[model samples]
Target: MRRLGLLRLALGLAFVAGVSAARADGLIVSLSSREVVIASNYQGGSITVFGAALDKDGEVRPPGPYDLVVTVRGPLETIDVREKTRVLGMWINRRGRDFVRAPTFLAVLTNRPVAEIADPATLKREDLGLEAAAERRIAGAGERPTPEDAAFVAALRRLQEGRRLWREDARGVDFIGASLFQGEIALPPNVPFGTFDVEVRLMQQGETLARQTTSFQVVKSNFEARVAGLAEDRRLAYGLVAVGLALLLGWLASVIFRRD
Candidate 1:
């Protein structure tokens, strides 16, 4: 009995150590200098993306004029694990309300003043099929979602239900970060020039867990700046000169007519 107890204690400690190492930090998301920006404080009691083993060396490169979203799961402490019981099914529903008045918006701005936006689909928890999944496992209702199962649901939502942009913002371009539960996104050069807004939201069952918003500016490239500044070649300068000439010509004509 004493040996068995010691073995159980060792296993328990190992499991806890693994969980702490996994959940030690949250994901911090950023873009490659000129495009995407994350706009909110993510340190509050929310899910973070730092614990997973990803193909970091093999991660896809981001494009210019793009948006990046990062999602994380696990690395749970006893408290976070305990809260998962309360947050799992209800998070989507609660978080969804913040965007109820307006569609959740993510946008990329360009120097050209056009915006590419992705809005999130408005869905309730039931719409997310969580209801059915929950129903199928009455036995598992008392159990927490295994990391694999939770990750699968998050992946499914990313593929099937994202928002479409009806009116793009004045920024450049943007892409939807696949999932709030866990993932990251990158913006690329196809974007124009203005402020790109990065928005991340966690929603379960159509409610929200949290929402974050930030902006990144896209300025003229060195080539673009030089071209824009050439007084002899600038169209705006030429147009202004032409307008002045036209006004002067009209004044001279009027003066000559009046003298006659």
Candidate 2:
């Protein structure tokens, strides 16, 4: 049994070594901050989210709430991110600046706030998830929404249902926190040593306005052996059985001694 176990471990190591040469991509997006606080009164105006720009060695902070600042470098419409609670939309209390502030207006600009974009790219209407007219107005709002804009309005309503999508405006900014957004993706033990794709997106209303796609790779530089082998052989299988027996024996011994 021990020989079989050793053989299985060796084979597992060999397979891993072969895959070690395989490479993967690590896509790191450095946002303004991983955490942020949207005061109650951030009403629907140009909103400003802050954080560092993207870099090779991205910034890291202890896990907590943060607002990821949006930074794009191209002719593409840039979208920002903010938090919104149930009561206070994204508006800041203009008066106190400490509490959340809800604007009197029923509807304000649902999209586009304080903006710094590289250049405008062809707005993918599909990404906007707006009807032809609403997408047109938002992409190039000449005036009030056209009949086509109804679709756009509906899209926003749908987005508000659960509030999973993140936005830049103050509309729902007050209730948000870093916990709402995604953090790092963890690679599994036998994650076929290679690059994996990580997708990041910006949604307004219910549509995707912009997207930043990147990848992350796992290297064989640091590997632990035990995790690599439990999958393949009966030898390791027997080891598990041995562990179970040992645990049971210990429990039984403890019970007998306690009774005495």
Best by TM-score: 1
**lDDT tens readout by residue for model 2, 135-238:** 34244434455554444444543442224222233232221222122222222222333333333444433433334543333333322224344434557786
Clashes of 1: 46
> Lowest summed-lDDT stretch of 10 residues in model 2?
96-105
Worst window of 10 by summed lDDT in candidate 1: 74-83
Q: For residue 51, give model 2's deviation from the true position in Å.
A: 9.2
All-Cα superposition RMSD per candidate? 22.0, 20.8
In model 2, what lDDT does residue 72 have?
Answer: 16
Global lDDT of each candidate:
0.32, 0.31
Q: Which digits, one per residue and each the tens of the lDDT, describe model 1 over residues 110-221?
A: 2222111222233222221222222222223224555644544343333212422112223222232321122222223233345544444423233433344434464455
Q: What lDDT does model 1 reach?
A: 0.32
Those runs of model 1 whose alpha carbons end farther than 4 Å from true positions after fitting are: 1-29, 32-189, 229-260
